[model samples]
Target: MANRLLEVSDLEVAYGDVRALWGVSIHVEAGSVVAIVGANGAGKTTLLRAISGLLPVRRGTIALGGASLAGPAPEAIARMGIAHVPEGRGLFRQMTVLENLELGAFQPKARANMRQALDKAYALFPRLKERAGQKAGSLSGGEQQMLAIARATMSDPKLLILDEPSIGLSPLVVQQMFSLIETLHRQGVTILLVEQNIHQALKIADYAFVLKTGEIAMQGTGAELIADPEIQKAYMGVLEL
Candidate 1:
């Protein structure tokens, strides 16, 4: 597709003798939210890492805006406009919230747009603006997730990759987090999210891919999968009484 923003085709990644992802392919169109979900060890995070250039690609290709994006350094990937907010938030615990955010603008292109980006970040998460002077480590769990996402926005990325945004968050916070994702989608950010919260992820995603044993086992529109009997049983934890 001419407007496809991110594409991963037959992507394979390995660690030592163990292969984490084998021949996985995904296509994300521009201006949409795509979700990847599966049981633990399904290689969802591995795919994001490969696309962001944190891990080397053993095979296949990842393209953003029709250009190869998986061959560069992690910093170079940021410059190419793929922002990955990893599984653990990955903030500098010792640094102030503002400092951690400033670090995300490390790439030359991002640095040049830092001011406007910072403004946009703060606008999205006002709690972050209040905590700008406080250390990232000191923030509450929900606030930390907010900062992680806000920091990524500082890079002015074309694609935002979020891994497990609901991890450690309260039920109320998870709802709020999902709300923010909806807002981001409305604001024109193309998002690729991996989450254990299958119900929530599918609710907002335009498309959903179910990963199993390091490969895409199922693919469909969000509503289609949400209603599928197999998906409902496997991932939804559906209880038939």
Candidate 2:
């Protein structure tokens, strides 16, 4: 049996009677990347928010490491080793590049391991190191995205949840971002990726789930999903020869 690091069972979320996700289940094995691909408003972001405890869950359970994380506070969830890099690169624009990263390690142990984490982050994003004293707002779009991931990783999270890390970047930047994701996977980070770019996302994901109208339309290995005709037409948008 695979080591199930994170398991979401029949999860649902709503906002003032408007449901976003309904009865969705997904699993992430240790040291693997899992992707959730869907159109806008398909609840991909909602799912990551729910997992991070940033959004309330109306039903179902989110379990990690054999414990139920249901109803935990966002901070509580973060301390439990889940880091969420939301859709927007939510950085402290006024803060220096290094300051924004330090905020990610607010927890005691993370703070204690600050030096190690900082070195790791810098190694992963040398550009950030070069701009360590620069204000976050001054960085370009692609640089901000890299900073967002680096900031999130400073916590040394067991599960890294990224919401469209490739969004709003040039094609070249997106390629660089994907390459970084692959590197992170090889370095033993379990990722839950929510991306609108299906083919690129599937290229690195171990498993994938396609969301349509807030529900999982398909679930399979990355290759399996890529080879699936229905999925290709519905999400991938073009036939793969």
Candidate 3:
């Protein structure tokens, strides 16, 4: 049987009167990479925010490892082993690369495993290790985005949620990022990827969900979704590999 690592059921999130997510439901199996793809304002970022506990869930439940995650603070959720690398690469600009990475292990246990995490992060992004002492703000856009993801991985979370990692990155760098995500998947990290880069995301994902206007529009195995004609026309453009 497949181990269900994370589950979100009938999830609803609203900003006062504006409903951003409406009954969004998805599941992540252990050690699997799941992609959530959609266009702008399609609730992709909102879904991540809700799962990370950064935004309030107006209804429904989120469970991680079979435990309820409802009403938890972002920090508390982090401690429960869900690391979120939000949209816009939210790295502390004034801080050094090392300092920014260290913040990922803010929890006591994650802090205790800091050395191991640091080594892993360095291995995943050698550029980060080379620029450890340099300020985060000094790096290029792609490097900054890489730093954000490396920092999140420093926590060694059970689930890594990334939002639009390829945004603002060059094609070459985006390829590298996707390669690293694949490597992480092989190392047993369950991922919930929110991205607009459909082709790249599907290439590395085991399963995929399409979010259209806050609800799940379609879902299937990566290969199945890639083969679907409607998905090809709407989200993936052409069916060419």
lDDT of 1 by residue, 94-121 (tens): 9999999999888887899899989999
Best-first order by lDDT: 2, 1, 3
Please say which candidate is ahead in lDDT: 1 or 3: 1
| Model 2 agreement with the true structure over 68-110: per-residue lDDT tens digits | 8896899999999999999988999999999999999999999
Question: What are the C-alpha RMSDs, in order, of all predicted structures?
Answer: 1.7, 1.1, 1.2
Displacement of the residue 143 alpha carbon in candidate 1, Å = 0.4
Task: Flag regions of model 3 displaced more than 4 Å.
Answer: none
Which is the winner by lDDT between candidate 2 and candidate 3? Answer: 2
TM-score of 2: 0.97
Leading candidate by lDDT: 2
* Range of the 10 consecutive residues with the lowest summed lDDT in candidate 2: 232-241
lDDT of 2 at 182: 97
- Candidate 3 lDDT over 1-241, as tens digits, reads 2599999999999999999888988999999999999888899998888888888899999999987888789888898999999888889999999999999888888899999999999988899999999999999988998899899988889999999999988999899889888998999989999989998888888999998988899999988888888888997777667
Off by over 4 Å in 2: 239-241
Model 1, position 84: C-alpha lDDT score = 90
lDDT of each: 0.92, 0.92, 0.91
- What's the true lDDT of residue 33 in model 3? 99
